[model samples]
Every structure is written in structure tokens, then in C-alpha cells.
Target: MQVKDKVVIVTGAGSGIGRATALHFAHFGAKVVVSDIDLEKAQKVADEIVTNFGESLPIKANVAQYEEVENLIQHTVTAFGRLDVMVNNAGIGPKQLLKTAEHTLEDWEAVIAVNQTGVFYGMKLALQQMLKQGSGNIVNVASLAGLKASINNLSYSASKFAVVGMTKSAALEYAKTGIRINAVCPGYTESALLDKLLSARPDMDTMLKSIIPMKRYGDAKEIADAIVWLASDQTKFMTGQTLILDGGTSL
Candidate 1:
């Protein structure tokens, strides 16, 4: 709960919120494991942590694949001796936003694989390790879209909704097992994902910012701070809940 010396694994640590979370954990003195589909990016983040005098290990694993996730966990334990916190933060969105009826099966499947099923795999595999240790914590990254509807992001919205459900249900099931599960729903953050979406629909930029009362996008470090708090003793009694950081957009 203190996070100091705790062993934490952050998926998708190659960039964006995932990268920030990994760096944040290491800054708090946790032994961090940086896992990402891209080894180069993962290693770079890990190296940054080490350079800052914090501890970290970089491991490449695609959360969509069961074997890769399993290997990620095994490698973490082999290096750190135990898994204390698991951040299921890896996710992906559709290439292009389209009408529900216009979306292809490939689009749906690809998003579900990485966004929905990927969380399932991370939770399932992480829970196994946590149960073995008799106690641990999980911080899932959902989205504002998960709680409400995103105009043209059908598959992404659906996958995120599933993540919210999974986090709550699993938290309830494991409440008494010393393993706490919670989720963070961030909205319109300044990240590569947002850049990609904006690149596809540049016109939506103004509309997106106008909806949020803050009139600005969130910083990745702010979300990372919230995640680290959720995984700490400050929120020890909290589980099966979502901490929304959407700059009042959800309001």
C-alpha cells in the first residue's frame, strides 16, 4: 500500500499514460516492470527510471495474447520476487471513426482484442498472481467514453464499457481476498492516442475541447498521479469504483 519497494507492472509503458504511470511508480520507490508491445519503447522508459535512480525492468508483451501476458507476469515475479500492483493500462482505438453500421468486422475485432479482451487477460493473469501472494492491487485504465457515449467511437466505447464492468465485478468478487481492483476513466488527455484521433478528424478538435468545462486537455502526469493514489493506502478501503478525471466533460 505504501508503494515504496512494492513490485508494480505497467502495461503499454512504451508511451502516453502508461509511460507516465511507470515513471511515477518508480519515482515513489517501487520496483517497476515496464511492459509494452514495443520493446524499444519499453526499454527506453525503463532506462529513464534507472537513470533517475529508481528501479525498473523492461519487458515486451502484447496484452492481447495470453501467452505474452503470462510471460510478462512470470518475468516480473522472476525479477522482483512478487507482484504487488498490476496496472492494466494497455489499449488501442479504431483506425477511423465511422457509423456503427458502416464499421467492418475487422475493426470491431481489432479494438475488442486489444481494448476489451486485453483487459480481461490482464485482470485474469494478474489476479492469479495476486491470489498466490494473498494480497495485491490492480488499477485499470478505462475512459470517459466508457462511462458515456462517444459520438463516432462505437467499438472503442463498447470495449471501455466492458472494462468498467469487469473492474467493478472483479473488485466485488475479490474484495475480501486482500486484492483491491479499481479503474480510472480519463478524458481527452494529451497523448498519442488523442493525436491520432485528431489527425483523422481535425475538425473534432474544437468540439472536443468545447465540451470540457476546463477548456483544455489533461496532462498525462495528472492521470498517473491519480493511478498511483488509487494503488496506495490512501484508497485501501476503496474498490469497485471509478475515479473519473475528465476536466468536467462528464458533468
Candidate 2:
């Protein structure tokens, strides 16, 4: 599917996979709305896109908040005149060892609020606009953890699993409305978050790489390509599906 002239919104666009996706979409002639909690970082990404001769608007928003998400959609429509795609990619995965039954409830709630509730709010608002337009696409970024269980982080895994379920259910509900909803579940990817994890547990990095059949980590751009395609016409017939990018880890 051609990305030319498409108006796409990418949440958590300040860094990592979100940043990569936003830049890639802009390079493909899409008008991008880059949203992040870090306004400065989001603006920097927007400026970089503009410097590269692409159109982009950076807005500060916490996807966990419904009001902020509503404003994000409103601002994008106000700026681009229409909304074609919404990428629900903003999420956090702070390492939380569940070895102790005394894990902080606050941490658990925070993860679920952002990773699961955030995606729900995004889909809700995006669907509202898309229903009005009669056509749209929603590409949710889940994780390999969504499909499998995580021994170390129970909350993160549960939240992601919820995302997988939500994506499928929403896709089925909106398929006849010309709105396709799908998810991309990525395995260990090379990103700033991974670097932090490696620093904390140096040996775990090698262990993770060996677990993937390819014996390597994925690049952010590789995930971005899958998301862009899922958001385009190439996947018009596809919905209610979870496209895995795990390098055969799940196989």
C-alpha cells in the first residue's frame, strides 16, 4: 500500500520504535502527528522531520489520559484536516521482578494503566473519528510478551495480553465500517530500553539473543515497516489478526 499523503498519528514518538515509525511514515509522504508525554522530545522529532522536508506535528499527550488523547485527535484533525491512521505504540515496561508476592500495587497499576488502558483510550477516540469518516486503520504495537507469559513481569505481560484481545475484538466489530484494526507483536528489539536492561543485567542480553532462532535482535525500522504496511491498503483484507515479529521465538 502506498503511504503517500496519508495522515498518521504515532504515540510515544519521542524515542525508540515510535520515533522510528514516525520518521519512516514521513519519508513515505505521510503527514505525521507525533505524540509523546515529553513535549520537548516530540518537538525535536517533528523538527527533524521538517528539516528532512516532511510534514509533521508534535503534540504532548499521555495516552493514558482520555482527555489528552481526545485533544490529540482533535489537534491532528485541525492540522491535517483528516485522520487516516492511528498507531497505538506508547507504552512502558519497567523491569519488575515478580519473585516476591510483595510487589508494589502502584507499579502494577501504572503498567496496566499505560500499556492496556492507554491503548483502549486511543482506540476509542480513533474509532470515533474513523466511524465518522467511514474508513481508517489502527495499528497497535503489542509485544511477544502479549502472546506468551512473562516470568519476571506479571503486570506487563497481562497488560499486553489485554491489548492482543482488544485488537482482535475491535477489528471484528469495525471490519464492516471500513476500519481495519491489527497488532504487531515484536520480540526483543534493539532500543534504548534494551540498552538499559543490558546495563542492569549484562549476561541476560546474550541469553535473550540466543533464545531467538535468528540469534539476533530486531531493528526498530524493521518493526516500523510491518506497522506501516498494516496501516496501508496492502492489508485491507486483514483484520482481527496479530502479526508476530519474533524471529521464530514463538515457533
Candidate 3:
């Protein structure tokens, strides 16, 4: 249950919440596997962990592709001997105005492929390994939009909702198999993604703060801490649950 010495894989660990979680887990002594589409960014994170925390592995893989995801899992197992935890966190949120329903089918397909199918692939492969080991944890990174409808981005919301549903369904199916599955729904976190959104509409920054009780964005570390706890022994009795770290925004 302790994070120490456990082999953990975090996808999209190059920046934002993914990077924070990778560093946090490594700091706690987990054998961290940092996978991202950007090889340079992944390596940077892995280097930092190795320099400060002693051990880490960097791998470049696109989560949206089944073959890439399979290879990521295979490589991690080959290197670490066993996979203890898998964090499905790689995603994209390209903003599109509903007024412009003229959006291409390609864009919609790309978003769903990465956000929804990526999680599905990660869960499927991770569960396979965990079932063999008779124990493992899977923590998915969903969004607040998954819980409620977000204006302007219909595709992102739908994809995230799928993540939430998949998390619950997988948890029920594997409840007796010693593999725990759960999700963390974060809202308005300080990340590159959010920064891009805010830059597009600076007024949204204040508007968001006014709506949330906290009056500010949540930190990446806060989300990372929640993930670690959910993935650790502290939540052994919990599964198929979605932990919302939205600073009371959803309240």
C-alpha cells in the first residue's frame, strides 16, 4: 500500500498535473515510469526524479494509439518486473465554439480517441497485468466537466464522462480480483491547459473564481496528493469512486 518501491506508470507525465504526480510518486520512493508524447519533456521529468529521488524511467508513447499503449505497458513490465499502478492522465482539450458546429469530424474523433479510448486502453492493459499479479491500482484523471456539462466544449465533456463511467464499470468487474479502479475529477487546476483556456478569455479567470468558493484555481500538487492517496493503501476499501478536487467548485 505504501508508494515506496512500487512500480507506477503515469502517462502524459511531461507537463501539468501529470508531471507533478510523477515527481511526487518518485519522491515517495516509487519506481516511476514517466511516459509522454514529447520525448524531451518525458526525459526531463525522469532526469529530475533521478537527480532528486534516485530512480525513474522515461518513455515516449502516444496514449491514443493501441499499439503504443501496449508497448508502454510491456516496456514497463520488462523493466520493473511487475506493474503496481497505472495512471491514465494523457488528454487534450481543444476549444471549439458551439456556434461553430462546423467543426470537422476529424477533430471530434481525435479528441475522443485520446481522451476516452486512451483511458480504455490504459485500463484494459493495466488490468491484465494486475489480474496476473493479483493486486494493482488504476487512478484515472477525469475532469469536472465529466460530472457536469461545460459550456462551449461538448466533445471534451462527452469524452470525460466516458472516463468516469469506465472507471466505475471497471471497478465493479474487478472488485474481487484485487485490482482497484478509481478517478480524480479536477476543476480549474493551474496547468498549461488551463492557462491556454484562460488566455483565450481573460475574463473567464475572474468569472471562474467568482463561481468557485475558493476564488482561485487548484494547484497541481493538490491533485497529485489526492491521486497518491487513492492509489495507496489508504483507500484499500474504496473503489469505483470519483474523488473530486474542485475546491468546492462543484458544491
Candidate 4:
């Protein structure tokens, strides 16, 4: 948990929160494994980590696919000798799934596959490795929507809610196994996904600001900082907790 020379794996590291977190871990002296569905993007991040801090590996893994995720963990352990931290940050929110009743089955399935099932897979595989070693840390990324219902994000909310539940349940199950599991619920943040949504809706900026007491969107680095703390020795006494970084939006 010192992070110095620790082995950390971050999924969805192509861009946004995942990318920021992968770099953050590297900056803190962790040997990071950067994974993304896009190999080029993952490799780019891993390359940057090495270029800056000198230890990283890039692997292509679609969290939604069990084989890819399994391979990702196996490769990391095989290469790093032990997995110290697991950040299950891969997720998706289909823009068109904003309509509660009008969204397609495909959209719901897709969101659940990546957002819900993906987190589950990451936790399970990471727990397996941690059990073998008798210790580890895991952080699953949920959302403010996961903590509370949103107006027009049905599929996304449902999947994220599942993540919140999964995090709590798994954390309790492994509470005595030396493996700690926790969740981070990030509110509306400056992410590529949000940028796309804002581009589509002209009035989104004002609408979003009005809802958040902070009157601003969160930066990706802010969320990454929270994740690093959660995965570090600083939180050794904590587990099954959900850290809400929503800028008081939930209030």
C-alpha cells in the first residue's frame, strides 16, 4: 500500500478517469499495468508511465470479456510476481440510453455488461490473486447515479447501482481474507463521456451547474487522487465503503 514499487492494474486506461488514475499510480511509484479495449491507447499510457517513471506494461483487455480480463490478471501477476492493487474502472454509458422507457434492450445489456458485469469480473479475478497472496486492495468505480437515481440515465443508473451493490457485498465477503474491496462514486466529472453529452445538449452546462452545489464539474485528477488514497495503506482499516466525490451534489 506504500505504492512504491507496488503492482497496480487499471482498466479503461485509454482516456478519462482511468487514464488519469493509471498515470497517478505511476507517478506515486507503483508499477502499473495499463489496460484498455483500444490497444494503442493502453500502450500509449503504459509508454508514458515508463517514459516518466520507468515501470509499466500495456495490455489490451475488454473488461466485458471474461477471457480478456482473465488474461489481463494472469499476465500481470505472471509478469509482476504479485498484484498489489486492482482498480476496476472500465465502464460505458450509451448516450441514447438516457430515455428510461425508450432505450433498447441492447443498450441496457451493453451498459450492464461493462459497468456491472465488468466490475464483478474484475473483483472476482483480483480477489483470486489476492487470496493466493493473503493480501491486496481493490477499488471499483461507481457513480453518483449509482448512489441516487438520475432523471434521464436509466440504463447507466441501473448498471452503476449494481456496481455499488457488488462492491459492498464482495467487500463483506472478503473482509477477513486480507483483501479489501471498496467503491468510489464520482459525480459528474470532466470526462470524455460527459464532453460528448454536453456537445449534444446546448443547455447542459447551466443545467449541470445548477444541480451541483459546487457549481462546477469535477476534474479527473480529483477522482484519481481519491482512488490512489483508497488503494494505499492510508485506508487499511476501511473496507465495504463507498467514497462519494460528487462535489456535494448528493446533498
The segments of candidate 1 whose C-alpha lies over 4 angstroms from its true place after superposition are none
Query: Stretches of candidate 4 above 4 Å error?
Result: none
Better of 1 and 4 by TM-score: 1
What's model 1's TM-score? 0.98
Candidate 4 whole-model C-alpha lDDT, 0 to 1: 0.91
Taking all chains together, each candidate's TM-score versus the true structure is 0.98, 0.97, 0.97, 0.97
Give each model's whole-structure lDDT.
0.93, 0.91, 0.92, 0.91
Sum up the clashes in candidate 3: 0
lDDT of 1: 0.93
RMSD of 2: 1.2
TM-score of 4: 0.97
Task: Give me candidate 3's TM-score against the actual structure.
Answer: 0.97
lDDT of 2 by residue, 89-208 (tens): 998875656543755687688888899999999999999999999999999999999999777777878889999999999998998999999999999998776787788889998899
Model 4 shows how many backbone clashes?
0
Tens-digit per-residue lDDT, 1-251, candidate 3: 37999999999999999999999999889999999999999999999999999678999999999999999999999999999999999998865545337655766788899999999999999999999999999999999999998867877888999999999999999999999999999998999888888888888888999989989899999999999889998889999999999989998
Q: TM-score: which candidate is best? A: 1
Q: Tell me the number of clashing residue pairs for each predicted model.
A: 0, 0, 0, 0
lDDT, model 1, position 44: 97
